[model samples]
Target: MRRVESLDVLRGVAILGTFGTNVWIFSSPGGLAAVLGGGGVVESGLRALSNGKFLALLSILFGVGLAIQHSSALRRGARWPGWYLWRSALLLVEGVLHFVLVFEFDVLMFYAVVAVQCAFIVGRSTRVIRGWMIAAGVLHVAVVGLLTAALYGKDVVGDDAADTSRWLDQVAFRLDNALALRAEAVFVLPLGMVLFLAGARLLRAGALEQSVRGDAIRRRLMTWGLGVGVPLNALTAFAGTDWALVDRYLCAPLVAFGLLGAITTLVHRTAEGPLRRGITAVGRSALSCYIAQNVLASVLCYQWGLGVTGGPLWTVTCFLIVSALVTAGAWLWLRRFPRGPVETVWDVLYRAPQRISSRRTRCPQGRSA
Candidate 1:
């Protein structure tokens, strides 16, 4: 399938934005606890601005990709979602390795698992998909409501600190307590399905592609999205306040959608230039870049390496610098190669079986027999 620059740009923004939230976690000795504890105005502000927003963007993009793949398969006269099952399976394997070896809090495994379920609805009627989305949204809200009530006045922080002295032990511990690590996924997967369906809906409606209706849709999304999203996100920044739950469940998703609208609008308006090209490149290789960020974080922040721990400013600085380097690397790599290393590997793995099957079909009759 041909690449959509807009999706790529939005993905680039998501990748960088994810780093904004993750940097604090990566750099803190207190791990997740330090990030959630609210260091100061800067930290709180960053958390309020980012946190769930980028993740939402990434999830939405995942849905968009699935929709695009399904459409492409139909166009090629292949079975619906023709290589997607293999792709999702490979992604799950990649996600598992990443979770066990790189970051315990990785979302890829959950995404892959959810994606398998998402595939079932690919060519379903719009009404059916919409119904599913609504159901998922309601469930998400209910779950969040229950969680809010359960932890209403409590201070929720990091689950447990990793034993940084022994890296292998830390991995083993996380592996043993895998369910705990996937606790967030229980709530997240349904919400992601909603976004995935929403993406497919948009594609079906021709909202993402360039057209008159697309322009009008983008405008509405920008206006309504920001109008509702900004204030709610602002409310989420107050630490130790009663509003944290509301901010997380309600405001965060609003802010995320709003950001997506704004990003889409900007990507549409901006002229093609070096800046656009670089960001698009980053988005194109998002998986590679994301994995690289975690790898770099492990080396820089973990006790086995630099063991650097600091406040939000330090983390933010690190994030910006690393992002710049990664973007530059992607741009340079793209100049010489058609795809990122990870993307190439993904394609090769998924396509290998098809290639073998085709070769077998083409073999001489005697040899085939």
Candidate 2:
């Protein structure tokens, strides 16, 4: 089967782009404070872009991929909905493992849950898809408002920092944050599903596969991204200057989209040189890279490895450099092999049964199925 090079490119960009911000946490004084915006301009700008913009790009790409895979299954006369559901279930399982073992901030499981809804919309028209996307976006904004009001209302009602150092209190705090984050995931998941279905619809319409059509679509998205994404992000940065209300929701997604637009446009126009090919390679093995990065970051920041907690922006920058080297090295190593180890495992779990079934059956061409 032909590979979707663009997906790889986009995934690679998303994974690496995320590090541009995560590095701050690894290198700052309290780590969490840097991420929460107590750091300087360098760290703040990085956070503005990394936290939302890249993530949105990833979500959009996820939608596009779901559509492509579903469409491909349809062409093969396979039951796409069932297969995709199974696939998402497995991904959810993977994501859970990732969250529990590594970071609660993991998004893969939430994406899987949201993407299950996309299967139902596989055959929807573009207008329907676009409308759904807009609704999802609006719903996200609404939820943010409701949550913000709830948190502040509680504070207004005298919910103070009663005690700081109790272990039970810390555990409770972590649990509360986990619940809040999961709740936010519920809102964001639908948006991802909408984007995924939209991507599939665009694919079915041959918008991405045709050069002229793809270019036109890219241009339009780019325009929207620039006109909307850029200004919102800049405004977010300004609002975030004091870490206030407006900065929390709008800034991240807008910045993420702007960066995604810029990178996508660049890739679309590039000469596909060694750097581009390398990015494509990293993107191809994106799942592995995503997992690998956390593992590496843990080593760099956690109590285990370097133990260099809270240094400066430049230190975080070093982590990014280290991450790139590690990613490049892993990507290069995988070039000699067909599938990444993690991807191979996922394939085996998801597809090996079919391979076994094919071996036991015969085809009309006097060959194996």
Candidate 3:
């Protein structure tokens, strides 16, 4: 199937924003609580602008990709999503490894888990899918409200000493905290599902795909998304309140969709140039770029590598530099290869079972006919 440049562009932008949101967690010696407590304009700005928005975009894009793949399979006369399920299974494995070895607070595992469930609803009627999306959103909001009421005015930050040890120790620590990781997943899964369903709905309606009608929808998304989303996110950032449920479940998704709309519309309007090419390249190799960001952050912020810790400004600077380098690297690599290294691995894994089965079927079993 042919690639959609808009999706690539949006994915690239999502990757960049994700990096911005995660930089603090990756770089801070105080962990998430410390960063949240150490309030300032720059920190607040980053929180307001990024926070949940990028992750929401990424989740939505995952659903969009599922819809695209299902549509492509229908064109080829396939009746089921066997290949897509294989892809999701592989993604779940990768997400597990990433969480255990690299970052415990990773979202990929949750995304993978939800994506497999999403596969079941891929070709459902538009009305059914829309109803599911609405129901999911409502459930998410209700759950967030309850969580916020329970966890309000609590000191959630820990005072653990900064680990100035080997990377293996860090990995071991994450493994040891497996229960905590699971708890985190339970908390975030509902919200992720809402975004996933929303993305599938949009793709089903052909909003992400280029069309004369899509342009009008995109404009509306951009206008309303930004107009409302920006202020709510900004307020959340500036307040620095510990209303995790409200921010993550409620406000963040709005900002994320708005940013998605605005970015998609802008990409459509912008003429082709090196800038567009570079961003699209980064998007094309989004998996590789995302994993690379985690590696880079570990090296630069952790004691095993640079052992450096600073404020939000430092984190933002590191993110910008890494994004530029990653974009350029992706552009260069794409010139020679069809897909990113991680993407190539994913494709191979997803197809390997089918390939082996085909080979067995082709070979003579007992005797030549």
TM-score, candidate 1, is: 0.94
Please provide, for model 2 over 1-369, each residue's C-alpha lDDT reduced to its tens digit, 9 standing for 90 to 100.
Answer: 355546677788877776655666555545543355345676556566565667666776787788777768878988768677878888999987776565556778878887888777765676777787788778866766676666552322222221223434534544556665466577666557655665566455544442777666666666666777677766667554343334545555554444554665676666788777767766777788778877677666555456555555556556666667756776676779886778888988998767776766645446533
lDDT of each: 0.79, 0.65, 0.79
- Per-residue lDDT over 1-369 for candidate 1, one digit per residue giving the tens place of the 0 to 100 score: 666658889888888888777777788778886766666776687677777778877888888888888888888888865678889889999999998888888878878987888899968988889889989899888887888778877777756777766679779978888998888877677788988877777666665667788777766766666787776578566745456656765667666666666777677777888888888888989999888888887778888767877876668777877788889988999899988889999989988999997788778775858
| Candidate 2 local Cα displacement, residue 363, angstroms | 14
User: What lDDT score goes with residue 127 in model 2?
Assistant: 75
Model 2 is weakest, by summed lDDT over 10 consecutive residues, at 155-164
Poorest 10 consecutive residues by lDDT, candidate 1: 235-244
Enumerate clash totals for all models, in the order shown. Answer: 0, 7, 0
Considering summed lDDT, which 10 consecutive residues are worst modelled in model 3?
156-165
- Top-lDDT candidate index: 1
TM-score of each: 0.94, 0.82, 0.94
Deviation of model 1 at 22, angstroms: 1.3
Give model 3's clash tally.
0
Q: In candidate 3, list every pair of residues with a backbone clash.
A: none
TM-score pick, better of 1 and 2: 1
